[model samples]
Target: MNRGRQIGISVSAAVLSGLLVYGVYLLQLRQIRLTETAEVVVPRQFVPAGTALEREMLTTLRLPSGAVTAEMITEMSEAAGLEASAPLGGGEPLLRWKLDKFRLLPRRGEATFQVPRDYVKSVSSGIRAGDRAIVYLSADGLASRRLFDEPVIVAAVKTAANQEIDNPKSSNLLSMAEGDKERMYASRRDANGSIDAVNLNLTEAQWLALDNACKDGAAKLVIAYDAASFGGEGETGS
Candidate 1:
């Protein structure tokens, strides 16, 4: 009789262990499902570069969590009123880098000047707006030093070919068919032409100094981006 009791006790213990394991397995499955899906912000229509985002232009979707990147914006409020840095298509996830605030052209007691294309290319192609760059003055392109003691912020980077594409004047043009716009951008991006120029946001004194340098043809503009100072990463020079 004792042997039978012991056997019954073992059987009960095994069944309870099995039930606990199964419950844990079910919880694991639920956790996986929840983690695999997320709500992300997506464009409702073609969003062109430099166009400010509005609530109507965006919508949310339940996307696979694995498919979303860190750069993908999750909220419409985060994107609204910001400009698109690049073109995004319908149903595409809006990325953080594809938007900008335009910031401002010039502040009080400040001015802006356009740096020649050759000068902008000297530093590298990654030059972006809001970057602080040191302008080098040299009669020829070689052997130069800083033009000013203070650094200057880049207001804009304009490629001759991409100007019209980025700054579309008409609202309809902004919403143009994706294919047509893609073709247009492809042609512009591929064309052999003058590519990049930097618009320097400067103080009146700084502008005068740069202007004099350019007019005399005694110095050429050579830009060196202060990578550490770009986009609130470090101190911005006035």
Candidate 2:
């Protein structure tokens, strides 16, 4: 019985020693420095707020995993074409929150398109994101045609500060003002919400249709809100 106990103990020690050796081998094979590094997408240059990121603006860097954060962008593809929600420094690791995705990448069959403010004529009612937009296009600067057969979904409405408008409690802040800082900021947010850039989710065909019309340098877009609790007054005419 004593001999058996000794043998069992020796076997257990040998297994543990083998496991430790194997673990060490794995660590050596993986190379701690290489295994500890994570690939993160970073800005190549200082990017201003509201600027749309292009492929040229981004680069990948191998940073220590310990330095990587949950919010840091890992894929360069993920950062391209996204609107910078805030200013980015040169060579700084790009964080996800710095880019607003609410107006980017839509459903599988649809694409999100942002209308430049320069193509707009006037905005009448207040607009917010998540509402559908009734779009019209004037290609000849004389005649206006419906841009889409249906009211497309507005993906996002960004303020001049490049901040995407969130679902606030209400846009009509005057009647409900509590005279607090939150109220003031809310009112300001609604005021600055968006009269300029409106992102819309459009079908691929619809996008091509808009593109074809605008190719002549004659097209301008106008947006009207469908009758709903959400409303905004914006016109599309070049």
Candidate 3:
């Protein structure tokens, strides 16, 4: 009888131990479920392709921790991201916490060119998309020459042909007033054709300067770089 009682107690203890272990596992799972993490989907504009997910980048992304929702993620762009975060009334801790919230992926932005149409047509006629241009803006005229005197280099074209010039077309002299066409023909008669305006990408300051200069008079477009990457100032005029 005593032996049977001892066996029963041992069985009961084993069952109790198993129950305790199961309970501990369930508690651990609950804790895990309650724990939070940050998740975000940054917009294409805010995040550039191949941008390193460094702490500096993170400082820009303000995110809250724990089971982050989609709304919360969208807000993340507005939160810690550069533009949004800039105005947000927050401290460093909030900024740092937000940075710790997300990851970055590949994205692209449009490369826009603001070249004059005439230049675009001129360069497009002679140059292919990937061609380089030694872009020259018209310098102010001196007493001896017309206000549109010499061309000055403003910027070097950085993008490939596919990305550089946009919507190139030839200017029609026939469409001009009879007198205007005659004058244009006479001026261009010494040249290959009428000089067309072209578009170019430049910094904010460069754009402002170029705009002011062009407003004063016509700007010249010369094909400085070609297939063989040849020709500029020293070469015979194209």
lDDT of each: 0.64, 0.67, 0.38
Q: Predicted candidate 2: what Cα RMSD to the true structure? A: 12.4
Off by over 4 Å in 3: 1-6, 25-113, 120-135, 138-205, 215-217, 221-238
> Which candidate, 2 or 3, would have the higher TM-score against the true structure?
2
For residues 127-220, write the lDDT of model 1, one tens digit per residue.
4455557777767665766789977766766666555223233221222223254443343334343436568778878877777777656566
Scanning candidate 2 in windows of ten residues, the lowest lDDT window is: 229-238
Better by lDDT, candidate 3 or 2 = 2
- lDDT for 103 in candidate 1 is 32
lDDT of 3 by residue, 1-238 (tens): 9999999999999999999999999999887766644545443334433222323444433345544554443343444422231222322222333332111111122223456544331342333232234544433353222222222221222233423222223222221223343333332233233324334334455456545655545554333333232222112234
The local lDDT score (0 to 100) that residue 60 gets in candidate 1 is: 94
Candidate 1 vs 2: which has more TM-score: 2
Each candidate's TM vs. the true structure? 0.39, 0.42, 0.33
Inter-residue clash pairs, candidate 1: 85-98
What's the distance in Å from true for residue 189, model 3?
Answer: 34
Q: Candidate 3, overall lDDT?
A: 0.38
Candidate 1 positional error at 83, Å: 16
* Full-model lDDT, candidate 1: 0.64
